[model samples]
Target: MTFVSFLRKNLQKEIFQVKGDKLIHVLPLAKIDKREAANYLCVSVSSTNDVYITLLNVMEEKTVLKCETRHNWLLKDLKLIDGIDQLQDNAEFCLHFDTKIFNLEAYSTASKYAFLRCLRKMSSKYLQYELQWIHFDQDFVGKSHSLLVPDDAVLSMQICLEAFTCACLCSCF
Candidate 1:
C-alpha cells in the first residue's frame, strides 16, 4: 500500500471539535496569565493542508481566537497529559509556543486523542519532521511528550547543548 493511503487509513483526517467550559492562557512571567470559568468554548482544527486552530465562543457562536502556524517551525512544543487537574474531569492538553501556552481540555479522552492525532499528522507533514514520542515517568510527572524533530534535529539538540555548556564554562573564567 502507498504511504499516503496507509496514513489516510490509520491516521485521523477529520476536523476535530469539542465543547468545554474552561480555558487557561498562559504567558511568560513578564505577562499575566488569564483564566476563564463557565465560558463555553469550541476548539476545532480544519481538515486541510493549511491547518488552523479555531477557538470559538459556543454561546455566541463567535470566533474568539484563531491561530495558524505560517511557519511550522514556530510551534515550539505540544504535550498531552491526563488527570493533571483533579478539578477537571476531562482530558487536558497543552500547546506551547514561543509567546504563549494554551491549556485546553477535551470533553472526553477519545476526542482528545482524535484531535491530537490529527494535529500531529498535519504538523509532521508541514514541518517535515519526524515526531518522537516519549512517555514521561508517570510516577513523577504523569505526562507524555510529543516532540517534532527533523531527522537532523538530534545533531541540532546536541549542538545547542554544547553551546550552552560552553557559555557556562566561559562565564566561569
Candidate 2:
C-alpha cells in the first residue's frame, strides 16, 4: 500500500487507537463556504512542513500545500508557513498537547475569574500553559490544553490561560 493509504487504513481502525503523543502540533481550520460546509486547515508536519489541507465537504480533505510543519519547543513562526498569509475570522485551530489534569468544575459562573479559583486549588498549583482551546468529549474528555507555558505575570492573557489550564488539567487527569 502507498504511505498515505497505509496511514489512512491504520487510522480507520475500529478500536480506539492508543496513539502516544511525544510531540505536539497545531492545525488551523476555517469555515468558508456554508452551503458546501467546506473547511480549510493548515497542519504542520513534525514542525517541518506547514501546508494547507482543504476539505470540500468534510470528506474531501486534500492537502494543497507544498511545505511541511512540526512541533517546536518555542512558538513556531507563522510567517515561515506558506498558506497562512491571512487569517479568517472564527478560525478553529487544533493544537496537539499532552498535559496533566486534576479537576475543572463550575458551580456559580463560567467566567475566567471563577475558572482561576478552581485551578489554584490544585496541589501542583503553578503549572503553566499556552491558550489552545476548550475540549469536550463523551468519555475521558475535558478541556484540552497545550504544555505549561513560561512565566509571565504581566499580561492578562497569561493569567487567564494559566488558570484555565490548571482548572482543566485538574479535571482531566
Identify the candidate with maximal TM-score: 1
Candidate 2 lDDT trough over 10 residues, lowest sum: 77-86
* lDDT (CA) per prediction: 0.37, 0.27
Query: How well is each residue in 1-173 modelled by candidate 1, as lDDT tens digits?
Result: 85323322222222132222111111111112244222222222333333344443211125333222222222224333233443333456555554665665654433444444444564566656643322222222222243564212333355478789999999999
Worst 10 residues of 1 by lDDT: 22-31
Q: For this target, which candidate reaches the highest lDDT against the unseen true structure?
A: 1
lDDT at position 92, candidate 1:
61
Local distance difference test, candidate 1:
0.37
Q: What TM-score, to 2 decimals, does candidate 1 have?
A: 0.36
- Per-residue accuracy of model 2 over 52-113 as CA lDDT, tens digit each: 22121233347422222222322222111111111221112232323422121111122222
lDDT of 2 at 65: 20
